[model samples]
Target: MTWGKVREIRDGRCGKGRAGDGKESGGGRRGRGVETGQSLTLQSLTQWKVPDLGSGEGSQEGERVKSGGICAERAIAKHRAQRTPISSKNSSDCPRTPRHSLNMGIFRFRLMLLCLIGSLSHLNSSVADEAEDISHKDADEAEDISHKDVHCGVPVNISHGHYEYLSHHDDDTYLSVIKYACDGPVYHLEDPEEAVYICTEHNKWKNAKLKYKLPECHKVSCGVPKDIEHGHFEYVTTHGVTSYLSAIKYTCDANYHERDFSDEGVYVCTIEGKWRNTDLDFEIPTCEPVLCGRPVVHLETHQRVVGGQMVVNGASPWSMLLRGADGEIIDGALIAHQWMLTSAHALQGEGRSEAEIKANFHAYVGIEDAREMDSAHEVHIDKIFTHPKTKDAMVYSNDLALVKLKENITYSNHIMPICLPAHDLAAPGKVGHLAGWGMGVELKPATHLLYVELGMANASQCLHQLAQKQPGLFTEDAPDLFCTQRSALEENVCRGDRGAPFVVEEGGVEYAAGILSYDEACRAYTYAVYTNIYNHLDWLKEIMANH
Candidate 1:
């Protein structure tokens, strides 16, 4: 009465009936060719058959028979439901026998159930196998792509059969590649070739007979190299003064201090070729609240000059006064010995001759009189010393020169030495102001003394690029003179501002630090080369002693 026993009886009855029919008709097989399962071999098949139910006796065991029939039908229905057609074929061709037909209703139900379960298992295995194959092929492709012999573009996997090329005319290079997936549930790239063929077994092969015909590619024109414009600063090892051109140093504007780099903060041109301050502790920098020191001399006017740090006496005509050989008026640096610090270039080669310089030269320390100097300190042609390394006439070096005054200045509120910057004044982040009788923002001739404030730049950065242009300029032999260009193009010191004094507001006092040097013609910025007094304190004292 078991399900297995019922199937055996059904199969037996069908086999016997088929054999009898075959003998009567010529002993031929009637059922379609059925491949036996390994589990249900030929020997096992003989045992499987439907039992004959003799009319009355079989009816007496109706309940047991019914249960057996139900179980067989469920199994058959499961099978039928799960079985998938391998190919396009007629389902009626493979018919069930009469005994099988007797249980066909039940058997069909079991057949469907079996087929559903089998199909699910088949689908899962198929997906798993396909995934594995793809992973394996991808790994292989990665290996092939990594080979050094492979130039940028052409097809590489000629062996495994997948092939294609991509061309982008708008792009700078022909290195673009087109990727494609193979057919079927197992989509893996088997090969890269002219013609690729995939099989049912998930094996792909490239046909050797097919030759690739590439599409007509348009020529690509690269406008600029990506790195030059967007690349970071690259340090080209230079000898001597090459470091100055790089402009790698940053000094905070006056009132601003470097907190990020601590004491070691130095401005550098980044690899991207853009200049940035490395000394700022925060991402964005801000100018510190700088308290300008009380000038030894009080000014009548509270109006601020170009440099943000110092104040000029409003009562004096010298505030916006013009003097010197060129008849151009520039803001004067109030040095200690009653000498006004002006741009050496303002004197130019003309100052080299006393006759040309003395006749037209005039010095006024905020004097009321406009025509003549209040105290005409004999414009003595003492030693005119420029930076020993200064070479080019057009581009003067450390463009600074000192004119010794005939008399010591009185320490009065109205006339006093502008404070000298404390040693270590030019450390990065120290804002300094430059004043000179220079032309306005435009390159016109100097009308009056103009003053402008610019932050100190790192010596290394200015020299880095300049060093390349002129070698041996940024060496220890040359003093530690750093250069700073105008932060805003409109605020730069223009022509006739050479030899201007750079002063720092320290301890509420303006102190002279360096001299305006030269202008970079191509750029809106001008270069002010400052002599490091701290570095040459001993020399300065020695020179003063001789005077």
Candidate 2:
């Protein structure tokens, strides 16, 4: 018979029941105490007759509750197959009941059996449908999760540490499946309806999944110079572009280093979940020349002897010269023609024109008296060149300059050349002198031409004392300039003594050296910013050739 015909027969007994809607009347709840023996027998017959239906019966059975009921019937078929057959001879003691009574009883039993089978079939169909729905829902959720970690790629055979979970054993049983995988044991759980989640992978899930909601990173900055010593960083982009891994680490080149306190080359994560490297190398600038010391002079006449041996004078003949704008006959070695190499602040003055200086000229070298100054070389200055990046207006570490002289003097004891300091000689704490034609009393302006000297002070003492005196002058710039003061208060460079000479005595050879420059408010204290003549020799030479 067809599945439809069989269903019709069952419905005739149960009075027509639907599977999904649970709309079967009188088949549920009211007949729980009724005998289940007849109902089990009916299920067995249904299962036995299922295979006898048309081939299409399988599809029809799946569409309704018949398929699950068939399973139950099959389960009963085995039980029935084990029953023993009775012999006709032994049936003589059978009661002689009326045919109508017997038929009614059998019909009533069949009705009850059909109702019970229908109910069980309906329940099995409901469970199967629910399971199918759950499977589809799980698949959709897994798809969404996979899309989020598209960049992380497929998580293969990935195993995590210990985790916690909840499980519903049954109406009376509870379980706690802490770690479902791995060797972790399961425990007894209480709540059945609540969902169980493992918190062990929270951090991993946050970094890999939930963190995607963070802001998009445009640029990643490395190194917190203010807070860290050194740091290394590594990162990979999870957005639009595929397969992006940041290989560039933040690190300083050799001979150069970062001042950050973070460990060298460590990767740090930012608020955007991106990473940066903060490793840098400390740089060591190339060493240059040392331009310091005073120009040596003839002890008998105190006249400047230009080309001679002093300190920092390498084999080179070019030496730095510094002269006072005032009548002070302060001297220094001549390093260049276009640029007068002297103290850094020596040029701190109202640069005078050649005519203005000539008009107000009072004294000249080689002449004993102003009246007989005709033979003395009158060097006219045109422009003063001071370093642009000096420390401050008054103090400078790179105390040097380039003075444009209108008339170049031929080499002589009074106009001779000096040596330029090399790297070895130029260093901190070196001594130097300052000479100028400034007034003895700083209160008055510079007057008649005269020479004075002061010994070189140690670089450390000069820097320390100067910084104490002028709190703002101690910096990277001050260490480069040398310092000195007048040997005697009676003779010192005053206001107009700027651009004078600073010299020292050694081996009886007079060397043209530093320039006389800045002094404290009173003549009681003075400061001479030294010159870097050797380093600027080439720069001076190039400018002079073109000029």
Candidate 3:
């Protein structure tokens, strides 16, 4: 028979027997129901067909039963084979009633449900932990992206200046320290406070506080004052936190006098971010003109003659000797009380220190005889100013220089200053007088004090002769050079004539028209070249006034 039909019949029989037993067996049946329910629940679990463990309806315990379904069925079949029929079974041998079977079934179903609930609980806990780990990873990745967007790329660039950048890990902002680049010119901020700029995560720059604006490289300038005439400014040094403090000194040129007679005229940068004199409202000094007179002797008395005649005693009073360490090197003119003019080549040498060159020179004034110095006034050389463009073996262009004396010389009838020519004195066939200790005939020793009258040579004829003798030496007619030929065939200037003045009388005043620069070998009909002092009058005056 079917198990359902047999269970119905068993229930009917238990109901009849329970009615016959009455109230006295009530407690005993209830106690036995619990014990039998437990025992039968265990057997039912082993024999029943397990449901398919699908979806949320089943658990790991149910899955085990489903996997062993065939084994469970075999166990149930064996149990049935050993069971006795209900019709012949004694009531005492099988005391479990339908009520106990019902209780056992309920207990088994409840136990399975509890097992399913526990499996679901464990699955949910695993899912929650995995989700938490993924969420944390996403957060870290987002933070990295944010950091890269904020501070990973290049910082903003500045022109004519530079900046320093600093970043912090916890902060989302970057700091920019701005500063000017040190180059052509330097500048400083008026305020002493520091300026800072902030760059935010959004890639925007903001100035925290700007007390003063930074100067552009092109705008930075040092305006030298122009209040003084015939003077110039010179840089000494610049110092300050922002390079705003500038030290400057002033000077005057040759044949000019400073107001205070001091060489040091220094100025410093003011706190107002301006360059000014240390003594504000101080009088702006000027370079005053120096008065000079003609020599005491007549020009006709110092005329040149054949065989290079010796000059009369004290006739060329302005003529002075440039004495080096060994002896006389060249001739110089007394242009002022403390200034002498000569050739730059006479005082300049290659690879020589300025001190060494200055130490080598001493001026001897009022001397007619080169061999005798007892009557000469010896003056120490303070400084030597050479022409800016004077170069050795370069055709003697701009061959000029000035000598400053340690002390002013006392003027006397035997010593005086000659006048500087105000206009061009170079003309064809014009005669000029030259005085120096140049070599005489037959390469003999130089005349004690020699004089020569030279006639100005034709420009074309001079250039032709120079090109024929020394090709490529005479390039073109220079503004500061003139050619002259001796009045007689054997009366030309020689080697020692360099730096001597070529004087020309104008209205009773002897003005220096030229200076002996270079000459061809001592031959008949050869021409000598002289530096045109008239063309450089302004330049000479300027140098004297500013130096």
Go through the candidates in order and give each one's C-alpha lDDT.
0.44, 0.40, 0.61
Candidate 2 is scored at a TM of 0.34
The reply for model 3, stretches above 4 Å from the true place, is: 1-293, 301-305, 349-353, 374-376, 471-473
lDDT of 3 by residue, 1-547 (tens): 4656434333332223421222233223211122121322334334544322322333453334333433343345555887844331232233323334444554676587456446545765798999999999999888767756564234344454454544443243434334334233353333333334555555555554543333333334346555567667666885322234667666555544344423246665554445555444334546554345444345454444566667663557788887667764678888878888987765564545568866776668877786665534787788778777676634567888888888787654456788898789889887878888767777665747878777888866776777677765564566677888766545788766788898887776788888877743456547887788887887788877976
TM-score of 3: 0.44
TM-score of each: 0.37, 0.34, 0.44
- Would you give me the overall lDDT of model 2? 0.40
Give the local distance difference test score of model 1. Answer: 0.44
Q: Pick the candidate with the highest lDDT.
A: 3
Pairs of residues at least 3 apart in sequence or in different chains that clash in candidate 3: 252-545, 252-546, 252-547, 253-544, 253-545, 253-546, 253-547, 254-543, 254-544, 254-545
Error of 1 at 313 (Å): 2.2
Residue-level lDDT tens digits of model 1 in 20-126? 13232224232222233223233443444433332333343433444455455445565578784332133222333345555665456456545544654575579
